[model samples]
Target: MMKSLITTLLLITGISMAQPNHLPTSIPQTMSFQAMITDTLGNPITDGMHNFRFRIERPNPVQGGQVHVIWEETKQVAVVDGVISTVLGSVTPIGAMPFSNNFSLSVALGNEVISVSPLTSVPFAFNASRAMSANNATHADTAHFTHQAGHAHHADS
Candidate 1:
């Protein structure tokens, strides 16, 4: 019984140690993703270069959304010990858009589309730009209302 217990403990420890680390919680302009590659037989694909295609999709209908690809790019990535890391917008430009709604990310290895992950947080840079625009508008409004000695303030009404 003691021997069996020791063996079980070692097996659990090994499995825990082999688990992959978590991906980044947030990304800015150049978005990145990390994933573990496994084969059909549940073995880790180690030391390989593969073509990966990434897509940002907008969901249609909102509730039960369909995939509408908004941005896409294909790049060759290196896989080491079943782990692959990639930047989504490095190859293709991530054009500016109003990120009012949540978007989903899809990764394709060669031709097979793997899975879609929901992007919960908006990129910090995009949010910053929006804030800057709001500040500019506020500044303009202040300038329009405040009349200087040499300047004439024209009221719309």
Candidate 2:
């Protein structure tokens, strides 16, 4: 009987440990978010349809440490075997907003909300913003030179 009990306990522990704790380490260019959902009892919530709200928020507020929501959207999602995959920018564009600091993710389902998850990697969109700023600066420099050339007319000669 003790042997049987030990086996049962081991199986339960293994199942509970299988749940994913962090987001993917690689930053995806397409803004796809994937997660595994489980209940408080560590049982996977699978084969269900649910409404999920996702939000990206600044970790530290400009005034205080209070979080500020930068982007949010609600979507009807399908869960298959405890895994959920959704493209974030599909419903609402994440846009070219600058991410100066690492942001946290908040997910709301039903009345329960989880807001402690920090993004594992910097967003691809953040790098894109830097690239755009560099391009704009280059164009501004060229425009300044062009303006100077136009003003350099021959002085009455």
Native-to-model Cα distance after best TM-score fit, residue 29 in candidate 1, in Å = 3.8
TM-score of each: 0.56, 0.55
Give the alpha-carbon lDDT of every model: 0.74, 0.71
**lDDT tens string, model 2, 1-157?**
9999999999999999997764454444348788888888878786779999988888565667888888888888898988899998788877655555787788887657944587664587567556544422223333432342323333331
- Candidate 2's clash total is 0
Off by over 4 Å in 2: 1-30, 60-64, 122-157
Please give the lDDT score at residue 77 for candidate 1: 97
**Candidate 1, superposed: residue stretches over 4 Å from native:** 1-28, 62-65, 122-157
